[model samples]
Target chain A: MTSPPAVRLTALTRRFGEVEAVRGLDLTVDRGEIVAFLGPNGAGKTTTLDCVLGLSQPTSGAVEVLGLPPREAVARGLVAAVMQTGGLLKDLTVGETVRYVGSLFGHADRSSAVLEEAGIADLAGRRVGLCSGGEQQRLRFAIALLSDPALLLLDEPTTGMDVEGRRAFWAAIRRDAARGRTILFATHYLEEADQHADRIVLISHGRVVADGTGAEVRALAGGRSVRATVPGLDETLLGRLRALPTVDRVEARGEQVHVHAGDSDLVARHLLTATDAHDVEITSRNLEDAFLSLTQEAR
Target chain B: MSTPTHPADAYDPAGRTPPRWGGFNRTLLGLELRRMLRNRRTIVFTILLPAGLFLSFGSTGQASDRVGSGNVAAYIMVSMGLYGAALTAAASGAMVAMERSLGWSRQLRLTPLHPAAYVVTKTLVALAIGAIAIVAVNVTGLLQGRPDMPAGTWVACAAVTLVSTLTFAALGVFAGYLVPGENVMQILGPGLALLSFLGGVFIPLDVGSTIWHIAVLTPMYGVAEVARAPLTHELPWYAVVNAVGWLLAFVAGAAWQMSRDTARV
Candidate 1:
């Protein structure tokens, strides 16, 4: 028999008293896929990741990792996680911390290799308290690599990193993923999800709003935004633009007007010829637009 | 669906070999011991307090009065040793509070290390700390030459005192899971002092008195009595019951709290 997917959640729900943190969430991640759980704050990204790590049980439903229960999978060294914060002891040096975690797996010698891969080998002697947030995140990354797990779960792993640090981190992660490791990370940054993930699963308020390739999810919004600079803008002109066929929404800011529509050509012609509008530009929707429209629609 | 009642029922569709309980980790124990040693306040409270108290009080009254096989000074020495061991063990066990606050416990839950293994490691650390405290207080008594006891009795008292501190270690673990990190020591410090009084470790109580009846019921009462048995030649059956009974209670409470601790809010 073949192995199951890397992770599977069926109708997973977690409630904290009156608040439902995760509600009826269902997702499946296959082997070697770099999947991103993209959502805004309080969208239940961390809650879902916690369930996958076996740190919390779902109030209802089931979770499976590597064709086994989450805890069982973790106990077999098949799954590891890099939490968002506070896993490092401030007093221990980076080297000691990595060595300690490695010893848990009986692989203390792998500490140096993982430290080198995480790009924190030179900071080995520095106390974790002294390390910068980005450096600490790298240290956490090093510890997560100690087990050489088949699946890696990262929850907002780059929240405190600079642009350069994020780039280096992703580069290292990409290299690791190339070795056939499955990675599922949760983050709110749309660009990070679009640029790195093979598949993006957009979640809002504990439910998935969209799930597909970056381009396909963008296409789900299915419209172009026509932007132009128009002088003497008034309510009548705004009304006319909103009344255009196939137009979804119209917005006016100073001398600029934005009209979202399925028919960009008609909106563009109406703006340039009918009104005194210049510098007209029409472009397909980006991931952020799709995220906003899709999440809003879910609401 | 109900939770799995047996380990065999855990999901294993791919038929991967199940991971066994790999005994306690030594590397973690070594690092934890090192961290405990580095904490100056723990050393001061666990070692110096009991040793200092013994030096001042053990020589105060009836210098040559003998009870059983030792003098009054020997009696006070045994009491002080038990006090220090209990304090040290409890403090060492309570280190879990800091580990929890740092999210280190949650981090460990993701690994192959078993939760029972972690608890055992912490208990071992407590025992180590307890041993240190017992040795420090006994050594101070030896160097002072104020306490008189046979070599065999001295070793026996120290061993019993060190071993009995396990009860307090479990107590510390229970309290660690019950309270926040910063508040653990603050609460347990005074709480232990009151227990010491009730146990008759600080002030001797008249036998068959009203307070004696109540003191025997406190958790530390059995520990104090059992540690001083070699000197007092007293090994009452109820003291053993009290010690073993409280140990089981605290262990159960700690296990319950720890299982809840992992259920993240």
Candidate 2:
């Protein structure tokens, strides 16, 4: 028999007046794993995270974090969150904010170490409001880590961060995961999930439509791409390629002909022989393509 | 081959634990006291306002042989204490309101800090502010050589003032919680003004007939009646009991509303 997950949702449902923000959503995040929640704006990503953080109550069903009810887990200092807005006091210096939060969790020295680990040691004296968005995000992460919580929920953690900042943030998360912390993060940026998540759950219209490993979910897109730099690509050949049984879509840009099809290898061989196309390149489908395809298919 | 240890694994020392609360209320009270003292605006309004008003009132009776003239000077001195209580209550409410607006309360709710701790912190902060206001009022009044009220009267008056501040602070918290942010100032401004006037903070409760009777039934009126008994050497058992009762009711009501609100969120 398997042990229970670090975080689990059993048919969770939350309604706000007339609208259902989250509906009968079931998920489980195992210990020492990073699960990325993928969704667009107003897709109930934040709402679900709020439920997990005990910031919002589910209208029906139940949620458990670290084997306890969400609110109970929070009271026990078993859960931590890095919200999109950072949520640090503006008047307080970075060090002061960390210390204040640490005191709340009954840990003072742990905050300083978390700050150092997040690479914001030099920013201790700066007021939280004066720091840049990336700096504030790092500080929020540091504060969340102060309690050594069993579950960490990050809602759009890298929304405002630049590319480099995001890379560093993910690296930190990976480090934490390696030490047996469970992380459930939500992000609209598919690349973050693709690069980091052990499993990905895709939500739309307050429901989970896809849940699997990166490769498994990508397979839901059901096709690969074949890009060929053909010497002469004409509309007639493009039409012929588009008519093939395996082909999903066809695009012609300058000297290159890109084909979206079910089997790129099979399509590439046919394209090479049929159009005498050379310089063929076959690439695996990316998360962006998979997401668009999946969402479109759901619609 | 040995596995590479991650940065998070470096602190894998077993059996490390953090400290828990010794006495929950005392720790919360001490923290609240520190916060109140550190707040510059609270210090100014609580401490400075009382001193300023006392000086303005005390200087008038300094030249007169008859200290308790029951005129503007006496009225101002008494009113100064009432104002101090009102200001402390208002400041307490504003601080809690500001915390809610800034999401601090919601964040704090996630911690091991109990609901009682949060409420006690606010109450203690208000009490500390009230103490400062009372001391400033008495010191300024004494410096001006206004006939010193009896020590027993001062003690009675301070107790009533503290209770009144507590009651008003709870009401302020309720108002801050119920009212929307855009209309906070408008709601609190008119309501506080009316309480101050009707409760006899500025004008004596005996000025009107039917209106005076009705105003005396108000929470502030009960506060003022109890607070002034010590100064006037006219301690009324009914007034003190009523004031204490109202303070308890306000605290109970505010706590109920806040806890319900927190649970809903």
Candidate 3:
């Protein structure tokens, strides 16, 4: 038997006067899964999340969280959200904020445990507004986890964080996922999605353009690039490199000539035999390339 | 093999069922009350401001003159109390506007708490604050050689204060919602104060002309009239009806606007 979805949106649409913020967006998140929602600013990512959280009603669609409406699910303590601003009471201490949120879910001790888990136990007595942005983010994460919610809705979970902070944050998210909590997060950070998401859903212009694994979405770019830095290169060799069947495009910058090809290894092997080709370094196509290609294709 | 389910999981501990009054409303009320109490300035303004005004106004006339005649001291005491009520109403409106401007209301809206709870909580906070202000004013008046009005009048005043607070709180909420953040106080504070003064909170209705008569048609006038009736024993039926009507109108208008706001979000 298949487990029920943590959240499901069927043709969800939200209109703000003449402008349609979210249009016919259908999506689902299952228990114990991490789904990343990728979209540019004003692409209905937040609106969709708001709808699933029951903060906003769909203009013409239905949304369910843990087999109930979003508001019902929230009352039942089945869903928790970590919004962009963290939504914490500024005057309250960290512990107080967590306890307040936990009390709403009928669990007080859970707040402390969640706080410790989020690595902010020492700052429990500190006021939330006095804390740094990263600290506030962690506090929100702790609060979101206080209810032991089955589903977590995180919007831009780590937008402004140092490299190490983001890694630690991702570790906490992974820990939560390990405990069987389904997470659906919207973020512009492609690397976070690529590294942590079990599945990614790309939204643009108030619609879902792509939904698949990191590798699957990357495959949407068709082929990979064979970027090589040759110590010495000539136009004859560049022309010869571009003539390769696997090579789609070629650009020469000074002594280094970069090649976009279906097979990087084959291109590198052919480049090694060239008279002026020396010290050729081939790299894999990253998510940036895939994202640019996908967004371009979407447009 | 046995499937394990936690004891807390078997039964909904938080009473997962939709509350008769709704959790959102309760939570909203809870948060609003806590926030209001937490602010030292708000507490001082809500409780002390009216009390001080009433005491200063009440002490001007000797206690013997205030006994049966219900002279200017008693009259001004009632008016000052009404002024406090108006201030409370204006403050409540400003508070809501400030909360919205600071994004606190939006944050609360994202919670599982129901929308009705949010509205009800805010209304209750305003009412509670208004009651505190009214009590402070009357208690101070009593201490300043002004004897208490009859229990019946006191109860009537309390009831009036409650209804007036509700009506003004609703108006405040509407103002907060409608007014832009930067111009909230500029629009609501002076606007409410002007209405209150015109409605006879500052100047007596009998002293003013056709405009004051027109002002008596406002919600604040009705509230002031109802509040002063027990103390002065001069109940104006038309003013009471007008206040009740305005209160109902504010409620309807607020409900409509809130529903539209929520739907738009």
lDDT of each: 0.85, 0.73, 0.72
**Model 1 pairs in collision:** none
lDDT tens per residue, model 3, B26-125: 4435656776677776676677867776666566645335433355566666667666666666667656655655555565554455656555666677
lDDT winner between candidates 1 and 3: 1
lDDT: which candidate is best? 1
Worst-scoring 10-residue span by lDDT in model 1 chain B: B1-10
**DockQ rank order:** 1, 2, 3
TM-score for all predictions? 0.87, 0.83, 0.83
Higher-TM-score candidate among 1 and 2? 1
Candidate 3 structure quality by residue, lDDT tens digits, A117-153? 8889999889887999989888878877766777888
Instruction: State which docking tier applies to candidate 2.
Output: acceptable
Which is superior by lDDT, 1 or 2? 1
DockQ head-to-head 1 vs 2, winner? 1
TM-score of 1: 0.87
Model 2 reaches an interface RMSD of 5.7
Looking at model 1 chain A, report the run of 10 residues with the lowest lDDT sum: A100-109
Docking class of 3: acceptable
Off by over 4 Å in 2: A1-3, A162-164, A226-260, A269-283, B1-34, B60-79, B178-194, B205-211, B233-264
Q: Tell me the tens digit of each residue's lDDT in model 1 across A8-113.
A: 9999999999999899999999777899999889999999998998888899999999878898887777788998899888888999898777777754369899
